[model samples]
Target chain A: MKQTQTLNHPLDDLLRTDRIPHIWCPGCGIGTAFSACLIAMKESGINLAKTAMVSGIGCSGRGAGYVKLDSYHTTHGRAIPFATGLKLANPELNVVVFSGDGDLFAIGGNHFIHAARRNMDLTVVCVNNFNYGMTGGQAAATTPHLARTTTTPMGNPEMPFNLPLLAWASGATYVARWTILHARDLAESIEEALQRRGFSFIEVLSPCPVNYGRRNKMKPMDTLRIFKEKTLIKNNAQPTELGIDFERGIVLGKFVDEDKPSCGELYDKTCRPSLTQGTAA
Target chain B: MEPAVLTGEHYMTGDEACAEGALAAGCRFFGGYPITPATEIAETMAARLPKVGGTFIQMEDEIAAMAAVVGASCGGVKSMTATSGPGFSLMMENLGLGICLETPCVVVNVQRAGPSTGLPTMAAQGDMMQARWGSHGHYEIIALSPSSAQEAFYQTILAFNLAEKYRTPVLIMTDEVVGHMSERVVIPEAKAIKIVERTRPRGRKDRYNPFEPGEFGVPPMASAGEGYNVHMTGLTHDERGYPDMSVECQEQMVNRLVGKIRNNLDDIIRTESHRLEDAEVVVVSYGVSTRTAYAAVEEARELGIKAGMLKLVTVWPFPERQIRELAGRVKGFVTVEINLGQIHLEVSRCAAGLAPALLVGHCGGTLISPEAVIEAVRRIV
Candidate 1:
């Protein structure tokens, strides 16, 4: 493996090479999803100097630590608000929040909703592995009903969040869903979000071979087979119809893409220069 | 550009004065949720920030408010957030994040009565100890308490300066009485008001370590978009600003984080004395209670008790040496506040049995009257 790891990789400039050998377990999908994001960022043509990454706590939250850009590894469940402040203050920077389902949905669910409702100018990427992969796979808000987790050996009894639907209902300007198996498509969707204005959300379904797959009696290859056989690509699909299904067919596509003024744009147009004029630095 | 500072005497509530002070201090970002007694500050900022080309956001909650403040500040803008008790409790976790990241920002807690939202609109000096120890770790914090609206304006600016100077969260711990009470606050001219910006990296960008200290043990802060590729985390990080999991790394990081404030006690701490010379008794107080303590000290002096009051301007460094020295000279101390003896307990500990430290404390929603303070002084004397 070390021999194959050459002195230069195409993505080396985008990575903190010194922080190599990341903490992700074998066959974990976060690495694939995170690299997809980095690829999107690199190809977006936006200034990397004016881009910042914000992450909350979890396995995927460690994504910010490996990036060779300005990043904030903030407190648990606070990545969006932190990114909001960064964007609003500078307005010139492209802020991205990359984190896990447990961090972004279960704990940070409120912030995600409000940020979307206000149309905060941010690109939020949620790596959904069905369970909390960082803590040996506990049941999470995105865990499919009947899925086995450490905390739910009998199977998760509740329904998981339909992320695409939630993002759509909460007023996301762009909403899409994809599996790690669709790496190219996911990266393209993110690139599109980077080029767009207002709130954008992309949910990436990933495999947790060491945690979720093992308990569910599914290997990494088995999950990959599911992603290959059990999913359908349907562009412009209705968001409400988007939900996870491994045995049954799963619909994957871009559900919402529209134009509206971001919160900052509206604030500037309505609230600026009227009260006291431009503030002296 | 419009003048950020309104230089003239104007009668305004302490909350409005605090918002104005933030403007004068170069705070261009205000992210907060509306809580009673502190809501006016947010209202003012929402109206005024954009006019100055600054940004103001009313976040979803106090946790979001604090996260936004820290984020904006890390983006290289002077930022702050105002809230009361319930909101303050929600912000404690992120406050620790700010401390560990050494992100400088001001947190204004215009305190209202609360064990659990006790008296939403009533004044209380109850969050004193909370401001110091509310966050989970053992760290020294800079906190200021203002007794009047005029002081509120000045202290808010001072809070920003100290935050920038020390690279730590500076808390303004005022009470509802001062927050809502109208008073004449004399604002200095725009160019006359002092502002301190965080030290930024000056040399080779690639070699600059975000956590490596420069002058005054404060590391040069590189904002997010500075091309420094700076990585700031709430984790225990090395000078390179990457997480280090070793025990030695934790010790070094935590120590430097705490020692920066502990070693500069003199520069950060402030206390004002009123007629304490030759006094047999001293009244220790801060925030709204300091106003009552002044009146009580005069009353005790009229009774030939040789009394005086020590007003705590910066409450968190706690002025321990002052308390210890006065414990030696003064016969006793009377700590007056609108709490169940929070500040009084600190005085008692520093007194160390050298003199009696009697408490004139109460629950929130009401002020500690001067008579009650005088009675406590009489007992202690």
Candidate 2:
């Protein structure tokens, strides 16, 4: 049987093609993460006219500038609150936040957790490249234990964050993870998350060729090869089955899926009494 | 005084009167957080707005509450937010955004004592400086002060009109006394009152840039999805709404923002000169403090002291030219507010270095009575 592939040509044109000799050398996971977002948007069937792309300050934040949509390049770590305002102001609009590991988990950690707990109706695509690429490869919250980078020249002493597990515990309705090598799978996960009714988070294990590649002494192609080899997409494996070693990066799928009331829907049903005849106590 | 349209009213607090005024002005969206003294305004809006198909939202925080009103205003609704000192402080950043983006909205600040969490239910006019320069950067502002509840309702309606006509944020600077005091106010029919809607671009969508200033230096606003790819930002922007940090662009934008109010000072600046026709001492006051000044002037008239009162209705853009004109004849000025010597300085400056400007003010909570203002007037006289 022949397979059907829905390629996103408009997104491909919108990408940095001329930089084809890209800032990111070949095999970088950023390209994979980027492709997944384009495919996800195409598959979600959301009206581009009512869609807004908001991002914070980071290499991942540059994703907003890349997309030919209504975009907001807000202050560092403030994308969640900004997108929150945009979503609540116009509930019909599809608001998505594209952020980096540092932008989402470090400075923006408070907003990230609260937004999840609040269960605001929006999609968050967080690209975890393990290190701060734009700022000369500093060790980020997502940097795996003992990783070497500009900040962690000898070895990273701090523990890494399990982003998907954190999102699940924090009340996010949908959570998933996929590496850049599984581009089609990553896109499918993103599409599923977007279609979900509440706060949806997709953690993409992107690779920074300029930072992660150079420090790890691996070529961009080798990084993609490692992603493909290390990732384990398990349908029945429990959380204990997946180990935390860098070589065993689990490609978790459909980790948490449940029906919960979104903040917008709840707000309309509760706070707004004038719209209906019901009274708010 | 043109035979007083609605006179002989009493027993109303300033805050309750402000609510009556908001209803009279047809304010539909009241998004706010309840703070002391300002709670009455929100409570009033909640009770009245829903009756008229208006929407009221108690948002997550003051920032969101303020932003929500701005958002609702863009959706073709007259919106307002009320807060005390601290909440007002929090709304400044977005207030500046409102100014730069040219969004028409109103914010009412019921002045209370503090640098941080001072008397919550008390009175002070400490935010006088803040009302003019609270937000960062330079831009024109229109602030009004009502000395009585009657004026509070009238001034609130006037604030909305000025905001819409100029496409700027208007501050209703009321103190705890004026905001919470009770006084009778005459409500007029909706048709008798005038309302202003923002100008819309006359040309096709493609030719419009949201920040492009028209003949009045106020850009016509087009809401989102109106087929106009309008761009707005807090940064200093050019005619096309693109951020232009160059010196020329900054100069042009700043000039237009300030000049719109500066040039229209005659029309925008308002004040009532009481018994100033032939008086030796002119007492300057605003908010609830002006009520005491009025009583002082009447008492002084009986005592043959020749004291008149200058009640400021428009607090910002200073009414400097009018004060300068008045300074030519008046012997001295006595300025009184809840706080220590805020508008007193402005009165001094506007006196053109002629008359001696004395200040009578209190620190926290409680109004400086008419007797104290009488004493100040007596000293100046």
Candidate 3:
């Protein structure tokens, strides 16, 4: 294989340069989310060789394919369980899951709740582009009411999920949300989440340039601009105060921050007897 | 002849025996959920494994359970999971992944009646065929069936050995009857029991490919972060473990996987034959049903009907040579099982043009009695 040096940074070198000039269109928010994750890995001091990136089926799921880490392109909505296995297998290795809104919320919704409830030591980075970008912009569980998509040409009738709140209630030790426009802060939050020793969820409000943009009459750039203007960030805002509206995105910040026993740590303490006895030699 | 001398004795159910077998085999990790008949396996592991300094985790579902076992195996621990029919179905996809990735692990399916939740508490061998082909695609499996608590323990140890040696998933196909029934089984010392570990690479780490075939067609396995960049997937992968969907790659990969077990047939396939030398007829069976077949064969002998018994200890890589040899001499064959004639088809195919083969089977629960098997044998004879 011919090796070429593109960007001098190690993160850029880790990327699949041959496949890039990425499939993501201009002004797509997925690129920002991907960049933030790369920066977070770089900042966390996690050895890239010791990291495994698991992703479900979607555009953001393609993140695993791009990273040079030992990655798994798992089945749709099954990244959490797969990552959970990897983390529990060797608690020393850093395991992260990258998924899209529809893949995580609609199809893998049960896994999301259960993973958080167990407080598994994993970092979940979900790119919420409002609709299923890969499937031509169908209405997603994260799509706000009144948003237009292929499934809801008139308007989305179902209520959008407050993902961070759900994670917080599900016993996630660390939870945060940010739009693609806030790349630096999102990267910082991801770093914090990765370092945190429990279930950590970071929801990135990415823009689906093709399906979500064309149907909503907002161009990719306009979506990012709207997210920048509409989002309200409060350091300590109550769940009731951070209400959801299409016109005004709720307070986006580190929503829940607490220390709790991670599943891996608890399991280690409880399960040590068997392992120690069998492999003590 | 006098009955075979046996040693070691403890009152325990088959599920508990299986757990002890795992512990004796040096299994340090167990990931499973609580399911009827199979729950004892997990509960025992949770209590005993922790006492032994091993790890036990109750995953949210069987999918995660199977995945965790595979993960633990890759991390250089002998790991296992136990479940019943519905949970077994949930594990099929990951089981296939384990096969493709060449991860060594054991899955204990305590058989229960099921088309869809048929009888959760009742015993059945309905999953006999599923044990072989439930996972999509062609791959070899080592499945062992036990008739009693003692065999459950010994077979579980054998299952782990086969899994490690073959670098494949070994299925312990026990049923609710055996899983729930309590019997005396003496636990063996670890030093007395045989153990097999995967061969590790010798030379430079950079030159090592995880899936590159060794002398036995099984590659050396190095765990994650062991400075070995191993790439594994459910897809048909090449020697380097990259997904190669081409015809040639698929041919090579599939052939190697199947060939590993096929070429080592003598070592992989095991069976027990009773009074076969001058017998005119043979009764073949496995699992709990084998006990019935043995009694019936003895009854036929008492009636001066030249009858013998062939008990299949290893189900898959299906004892073809032994079946062929036994078929050549026996006048006819009677195969019995708990399921409705699954393994009978294999017996028929193996005995094709040699003799008539009859199936004595029952669905839903327990084994068909010795009388039922005797009736089938009389008709065939």
Highest TM-score among the candidates is held by which one?
1
Tell me the spans in candidate 2 whose CA falls farther than 4 Å from its real position: A1-43, A53-90, A97-118, A124-170, A176-196, A202-254, A271-281, B1-13, B16-30, B43-55, B71-77
lDDT of 3: 0.83
* lDDT tens readout by residue for model 2, B1-381: 111122334466778777666766767677788899799889877766656556565655676566556555554466788999999997887787678767788999999999799999888999988999998999889999988787887898899888887888899999888887666776565677777778877878767777777756788877543445444555577876655679999999889888878878887989998998898989888887887888888998998899998888988978787778778888888898888788998999889577888888878688788788778777776
**Which regions of candidate 3 deviate over 4 angstroms?**
A1-9, A12-28, A47-49, A133-139, A146-156, A239-245, A268-281, B1-8, B245-247
Q: Indicate the worst ten consecutive residues by lDDT in candidate 1 chain B.
A: B372-381
| lDDT agreement with native, every candidate | 0.92, 0.76, 0.83
Supply the TM-score of chain A against the true chain A for every candidate structure: 0.95, 0.88, 0.92
- Per candidate, the number of residue pairs that clash is 2, 14, 10
By TM-score, is 2 or 3 better?
3
The Cα error of candidate 2 at residue A96, in Å, is 3.7
In candidate 3, the second chain superimposes onto the true chain B with a TM-score of 0.96
- Please give the ranking of all candidate structures by DockQ, highest first, separated by commas: 1, 3, 2
The iRMS of the candidates, in order, is 1.5, 6.2, 5.7
Give the better candidate number (2 or 3) by DockQ: 3
Model 1: lDDT equals 0.92
Query: Any idea what lDDT model 2 has?
Result: 0.76
Question: How accurate locally is residue A82 in candidate 2, as Cα lDDT from 0 to 100?
Answer: 56
Alpha-carbon error at A253 in model 3, in Å?
Answer: 1.5
